[model samples]
Target: MTSPYNNKENITDKSSDVVWHNATVTSEQRAEQKKQKPVVLWFTGLSGSGKSTVANAVEAKLMALGKHSYLLDGDNVRHGLNKDLGFSDADRIENIRRIGEVAKLFVDSGSIVLTAFISPFISDRQQVRDLLEHDQFLEVFIDTPLEVCESRDPKGLYKKARSGEIKNFTGISSDYEAPLNPEIHVKTAEFSIEQCAEQIVDALIERKYFSF
Candidate 1:
């Protein structure tokens, strides 16, 4: 996909006067203080596939274990940071790009950032993964069949999409590109929300992101 934000000339022109300033208090120091490894838990799937549900649960679990964390839900971000963006493919790409940048900053600040977004395009998700170190980025795919998602339709989005009231809705109008090698995959259709959240917490523990 072509990204208006990726224009090399535009980027160079915009960044020409900017200088990098190294902070004395580094990410490592911040993480050490927090007693947890900073990382980004990116949840991707169709809307109503339980991304936010599972993410909120996982964040609660992390907090109970004394891990510093933050959650950036798609709808919440749209209310502020990404309100100017839209549902077009280009706008979606820009949205993910901006979120990826913000998540990186959160990681740098020593917080395990949990992002709940549809992030339908594999290329867009991959772009976000490339923003962080390999171990710092964990793709959590909430795998629910479209039929199940449509049936759940918590926000009435699927119904709207089916009726043509919504355009470019993922899984209905837009294509949802499944992750090829996600670090964790939760089949939400088969698992309870608590179970899915616990599974992610276990994965984080196994990966040594934090200790309980």
Candidate 2:
């Protein structure tokens, strides 16, 4: 049952094992082309709290400004890389962990990464923050009040969660741990989606995370 390729006894040494090499297109080159430095905008909040809304708007704005960027929406990612994960606490943590690693890689590739997820646990959010440099990781807490999120209920999830149809729902069956000191906290209850995107862009500019 052995494969024909295994009969050759192929072996790899230390030199080949280490694939580290200088980038042909450096970060500086990317910055110059995009007119901005790349970073990971880690958006954390409860479902129906406008995390994805704001993240999408921010990415669109960045694109209009000629910046390279991409968004890692929770629902979208779950359908792909994290398809097997469920809504349990442990699954939530692992989901954030995988997304964080992927976002960090996107940042390293000289592209701004916008991640929108209901990362309810402060610890899980902090774990994602620890994956990047101070200027590279921007923790944006979409502080939408429970009442506001419930009222919005864009996806009807809040109603299902409250009716006991859904389990481990953040801000409902599950607890949401607010960030102690996030880089940017958008109180969505009081601000429009455009306002939230502007606030995030202002923070990025203030931090000098973008050259222009």
Q: Could you tell me the lDDT of residue 173 within candidate 1?
A: 85
Q: Candidate 2, residue 17: CA error in Å?
A: 8.1
Instruction: Tell me the tens digit of each residue's lDDT in model 1 across 21-97.
Output: 99999999999999999999999999989999999999999989888999999999999999989999999999999
Clashes of each: 0, 0
- Candidate 1 lowest-lDDT run of ten: 2-11
lDDT of each: 0.94, 0.86
- Tell me how candidate 2 scores on lDDT: 0.86
- Winner by lDDT: 1
